[model samples]
Target chain A: METYIFYGIAIIALLVSFQKNRAKTRSALKKAWKSFENILPQLLTMVLLIGTLLVFADTALISKIVGKDSGWLGVLLAALIGSVTMIPPFVAFPTAAMLLRAGAGYMQIGAFVSTLMMVGVVTMPVEIQYFGKKLTFLRNLLAFVFSFAVAWVIQGVVG
Target chain B: MKKGKMILKRYRFALITMAAVGVLLLLQPQIGMKAIQNSTFQLQQMFFVIPPIFLLLGLLDVWVPKTTMVKYMGEGSGIKGILLSFLIGSAAAGPLYGAFPVAAVFMKKGIKFSNLMIFIGAWSTMKIPMFLFEMGSLGVKFALTRLAVDIPGILMIANTLQKMLTAKEVEEIYQKAETLLD
Candidate 1:
């Protein structure tokens, strides 16, 4: 669904740009390809890393690691796993619910979900390519800490 | 041969990981095959979503004027800039890495640093469709509470990050952006 919308807009934009100026349209296409190629190496590496991490940290293992009685330590572990693994929301939420059913506490699940969305240890290479090292690390570190706050708030409200 | 060497240097990390996977395949076939499947699935998702995004980014670079971007999102664009950043970021439809290229374009077009961070924050967590999914899957209380906490949290984080960088560092980032797109 989201892919379609992106394609729709991109094609329309290309057509409009072509109508306006053929040369400019061609440059846009070139720029698009260049940018995509620029990050391909890092992206390939990230995809493989995510694959390995996901296999080891599969749902069953994750649930067992962050079970309900695990407390703050579980939240830390959950945040660490979330930071390293890059799961899409479509998979992440349902997995979170499953973990909850499997006895993961709200705080741990909250930390997991928050870090999963915000911090990206796997995507760091690509991010550093764009923003440089300092900003990228700073942002992720801050987000890692902030996930704890998110965990606590969710626990208070939902648990 | 020289070109091949350059390509090898550029893709060293990927090659190393591939070799690791190969070793894993030899030693632990089941886990290795599952990893390969997982990587294939991720690669498929990337191909589906990434092409059009890069295309749109290209069009945006060619079409949108720096002056216009600055007027709306630069320093002194103030609250309006912040709001626009949040809107654009929240309306986006990919993983966080997708946001970085868009952000590079934003920096090239002279968006304020804090607003750029805000945009990233929103892109990271406040996505509307994702929010709907969260509500349905995690319960309304969890979803709403996360949303409520996240808005202020994003602002605070963005502000702090913006302040943490030296003026020289921020300028260097913008200079880097100039090279990234061109």
Candidate 2:
């Protein structure tokens, strides 16, 4: 999978760098660990927040919220759920399929999926740690708003 | 002892949150248990994706010169920068939050702000593996439709944000990134 490819590239690059200059390779590893450790505290907290949020936004509740024929209400609920929650896309798509089967509208699912990818309410603190408050806020706000367009387009083309 | 204190200071928010979660467990056992499971699940994903990214980022930091990044993705790097930004982002494998650190590194390396935003956009929505999965779960038509809409939206967002942030703001962000890497 993609993980395998990333591991392969990283190992190969590490080997090449080692052969070229051991010190440089060592420094690279150190730098990597430092940066990761610097963010670890925030990252851990974000994961916990996502966990709590996901518990409330579980699939059954989501399907209920965005039921078919719910129209804009469903889209709004879906977008709000997607914005707040942080489910992995791998799990999310299958769950989306299940929601669709359970009578959720495509427009709602579209909003949910798009916002799920683009907006990260729970991860805002970690984002702010790296991106600064202004840019992070602006970026997520923009993504959240644009997700409705994504929903509309998908509904038009596929739903 | 000092380092331990520093670590605790840095992790104060996490500690408070964990304490709150414990309180939730006492108050609502069912939801609390589920939340714990969900948190562990997220932790699993984070471990799988985070290490290699930081490793690659580290390598990128040491090996790639700022000049090289600028030549390709900096101001006036133009269409090539845009394409490269998209490719780097689309090929990525982690959550959008993961992209922020990479974006920080990009800023340190002098990548153009717009290209950096494009990279973030690509990471957020156009990820290739995620796209394939979306196709499988949501149908190819829905997946493709989102991708088509997203491409333009990504560009518009990056440009709009670029316009919104003043030159001083952008410089300050880059400076913040530089210090962060150090």
Tens-digit lDDT track for model 1 on B1-182?
99999999999999999999999989999999998997887677657656776787777767755344445888898899999888778766568999998888889888899999999999999986577657656888998999999999899999999889999999999899889998
Which residue ranges in model 2 land beyond 4 Å of their true spot? A1-64, B1-70
User: Clash number for model 1?
Assistant: 0
Against the native complex, each candidate's DockQ, computed on alpha carbons, is 0.46, 0.44
Off by over 4 Å in 1: A1-64, B1-70
Clashing pairs in 1: none
How would you class the docking of model 2? acceptable
**lDDT (tens digit, per residue) of candidate 2 on B116-160:** 999999999998757765765677788899999999999999999
Question: Where does the lowest 10-residue lDDT sum fall in candidate 2 chain A?
Answer: A94-103
Candidate 1 per-residue lDDT, tens place, A1-159, comes to 645766887799889899999999999899878867777887788778767867777766655678766789999999999999877775577567656755678999999999999999999999998889999999999999999999999999998
